[model samples]
Target: MDDRRLTDWMEGYVRAWNSNDPADIQALFTEDAVYLTEPYAEPWQGRNAIVRGWLEIKDEPGQTTFRWEPLAVEGDLHLVQGRTEYRIDPPRSYRNLWAIRLDGDGRCFEFTEWWMKEPLPE
Candidate 1:
């Protein structure tokens, strides 16, 4: 997909993240989508499961800030490099890479997130 399409999807994703609304989360993916929180971990398959899984570990609204830039695009696959910084006390941060595959309808059919925590200060 193109940068604009991916950006729109990313915006929707962040909006969903902030809202923790099932409909918002559900809209970002397709019916048969597969969502992998890590490369080698079990996936939340299908829209219903994805919604449930996301809610189970949902982060509170305004709990974090996120920024991202496009990394690459190969046909339907898009990659993004991002940073997430939590706003709570004893703050935390992470670097992220998201590999997203979208269907013709512009909804993600497969999404895998790779992330690493930043080392805390002494």
Candidate 2:
């Protein structure tokens, strides 16, 4: 994908996360997409499953802040590194690495992420 397309997609991802809207989430993926929350876990397959899985762990709208930068793009795959900050009682942050593969229509067919919680300061 081109840089503009990638930027638009990432922005949409952040919007979808904050909105937690089922339609927003569904719009990002294909009907038979696969979403892997972690490397070792079973992926949430298909749009319906993906929507259900996302809602199960859904964050409240406007509860988190996210920043992401494109790392690379090769063929249909796009790699990105991101940081997410949660504004809870005790704030928390996570660093994320994502590998996303987009179909011809710009919907993701496969997505995987590795997220690490930031250690508290001493």
Candidate 3:
């Protein structure tokens, strides 16, 4: 995908996260997509399962903010570095790296994310 399309996709992803709407989540992936929360874990396979898994850990709407930058793109694979801040009583943040593979239709078929908690500022 081109830079503009990637940017638009990421923007939609953030919007979907904030919306927490099932339809929104479903639109991001292909029917047989696989979503991995970590490197070795079993992926949430298929759109139905991905949607279910997402809801299981659903973030409250407008409760989190994300900033992401595209690192590289090779063929259908796109790499990104992102930071997420959860607005809560005790705010939390994470450093995230994502490898996403988009299908011809621009829907992700494989998505993997590696994340670590960000240390609180002194």
Using lDDT as the measure, which candidate wins? 1
For model 2, how many clashes? 0
CA-lDDT, candidates in order: 0.94, 0.90, 0.89
Per-residue lDDT for 8-120 in model 3, tens only? 67877998898888898999999999999986888999999998999999999989889998999998899999999999978999999999998777889999999999888
Instruction: Compose the digit string of candidate 1's lDDT tens values, residues 14-114.
Output: 99999999999999999999999976778999999999999999999999999999989999999999999998889999999999998777899999999
TM-score per candidate:
0.95, 0.95, 0.94
Question: What lDDT score is found at residue 69 in candidate 3?
Answer: 89
**Candidate 2 vs 3: which has more TM-score:** 2
- Cα RMSD, each candidate: 1.4, 1.3, 1.5
Error of 2 at 78 (Å): 0.4
lDDT of candidate 2 over 6-87, digit per residue (tens) = 7777877888898889899999999999999987889999999999999999999988999888899998899999999999
**Residue 4 CA displacement from its true place in model 2, Å:** 2.2
Off by over 4 Å in 2: none
Identify the runs in model 3 with alpha carbons over 4 angstroms from their true place. none
lDDT of 2 at 119: 89
| Model 1, runs deviating above 4 Å | none
TM-score, cand. 3 vs. native: 0.94
With candidate 3 superimposed using the best TM-score fit, by how many Å does residue 89's alpha carbon deviate from the native? 1.9
